[model samples]
Target: MREPHRTDSATATRDTRPVPCRPADARRTVRHAVAERCRDRALTCAGQALDDALLVTSELTTNAILHGGGITGFDVAVDSGGVRVSVSDRSDDVPVATARPDEPDRCAAGGRGWPIVCRLARDVRVACLPCGGKCITAVVPLR
Candidate 1:
């Protein structure tokens, strides 16, 4: 398991420094980090929260790769409130949740990541970096 960089301070408990973007393995890396942090915090890893967290992580990372112009940073933090997963990319395009199709189309091959993230996460935020990028953060409650 590759360890992501860390920043320990008095106020913040567990915050990852920032993992470089690797689209192919971004989902796997973020999921692993989330699980490890949950375990470290003594949170149940086999519960629905964990499952939702992993699914949200995958959706966010996939969006970053496909629509955000490649991922530039990734971070996962676990605390009393909940688990927060942040994915940054070069593109400043904000993610919008698209409505589900009225009818099942066999040829439909894309769209749905944002809605899944919104549904799974308790809160979602998008912050524009001063440097010229944006970071999307999603928080999932342990309970």
Candidate 2:
């Protein structure tokens, strides 16, 4: 006679809760998410995609710290297609328009983080939070 196997949904499910991280700490959180999510899966170009993900993570959090009065919330979700990163902060100003590179006078005050983020992310979105801030979501494709 064989004993029956047990399945634990609570233990198996990944916690989908929002993780509050400092600007510098978000990257590590992403790295861990990527590693855990990619453990069994295989992607031929994961290296470059991972780099892009990390860069995007750095830019969002750094921008929050520098311009948005620090990060309020952060979350990362890794799937077979890509990694989705959401960074929330305390600001209402638009990231791209406010710091458009074509306008040298205003652009010179900021670094290249926004442009880099826009270029690397497959899909990017920004939404105003009801609590008086904004959230930026960027999805970097793994393929």
Candidate 3:
């Protein structure tokens, strides 16, 4: 997981629902749905940025399973600028996006998730709930 990106709060609204992405398969499906629903909602912002949004969702969900202890639930929201995806897990460790310069090969895996999310999302945020959990969110812009 990575640190949530930043964007002005004045232009976006929160739209979230419960989803299960603890399992690898479920996470994949959720990622797909983030793009699908975003497009279906007629949120024009999603059309051009769906791929980045999907990638961001995938990373967040994957982090939830690996670091957050497990994906208890998740949600998706969209605004004029782009789509917002949120994943809630059991842990409170805030994810920080870091740049790894050692890996010259851009195709390498393992440490790119957070960096990717930060790059793709217009804004990313993480909030800790009182009940031992946290929600990581990302907003991807349209074309």
Candidate 4:
């Protein structure tokens, strides 16, 4: 199992807090827990934003697998302000969001993922860490 990266408290303030979560199925349960926190805090309306959060997590995870080589684990953190989803993968390659002008259909699925993530999330960040790995995080504002 891969270990979570260590960072200072100052950095952690802006990060997803690097929670240990299973890369596969457990991510769903973890996401649900975060969504529930959002709900309990009254940060969002409940259903729609939770769906959006899940979708963003799915895209980030898929990007980790397809472009960042593969992932061993991921994290989801929620506060009163927003929801942060981060997927840690084995490659340092940065993910670029691109849509071909001529072939609009080229992004029908795989490529469209980033676009959706960008639109739904208030902020998006892609980090290529020095240690031959990457973390893509999306911050979706509550309500």
Which regions of candidate 1 are displaced past 4 Å? 1-24, 38-41, 100-103
Candidate 3 lDDT over 43-137, as tens digits, reads 55434466676777788888888888888867665556566677788998888756778668878767877888888887778888778789877
Report lDDT per candidate. Answer: 0.71, 0.75, 0.68, 0.65
Better of 1 and 4 by lDDT: 1
The model with the greatest lDDT is 2
| Better-scoring candidate (TM-score), 1 or 3 | 1
Better of 2 and 3 by lDDT: 2
- Candidate 4 C-alpha lDDT tens digits along 1-143: 23343434332223233443334553565466565674555555367777787777777777777776777547666665566777778887666676567565654546777788999999877776656687777777656
What is the RMSD of candidate 1?
5.3
- Which residue ranges in model 3 land beyond 4 Å of their true spot? 1-18, 22-47, 98-108
Give the TM-score (vs. native) of candidate 2.
Answer: 0.76
Clash list (residue pairs), candidate 2: none
lDDT of 2 by residue, 35-107 (tens): 7666645444358898999999999998998999888878777775577788888888879634455675763
For all predicted structures, in order, the TM-scores are: 0.76, 0.76, 0.68, 0.71
Candidate 1 least-lDDT 10 residues: 1-10
Worst 10 residues of 4 by lDDT: 7-16
Off by over 4 Å in 2: 1-21, 42-45, 97-109
- What are the per-residue Cα lDDT tens digits for candidate 1 across 66-120? 8888788887776655667888888877888666574477467668778888998
lDDT of prediction 4: 0.65
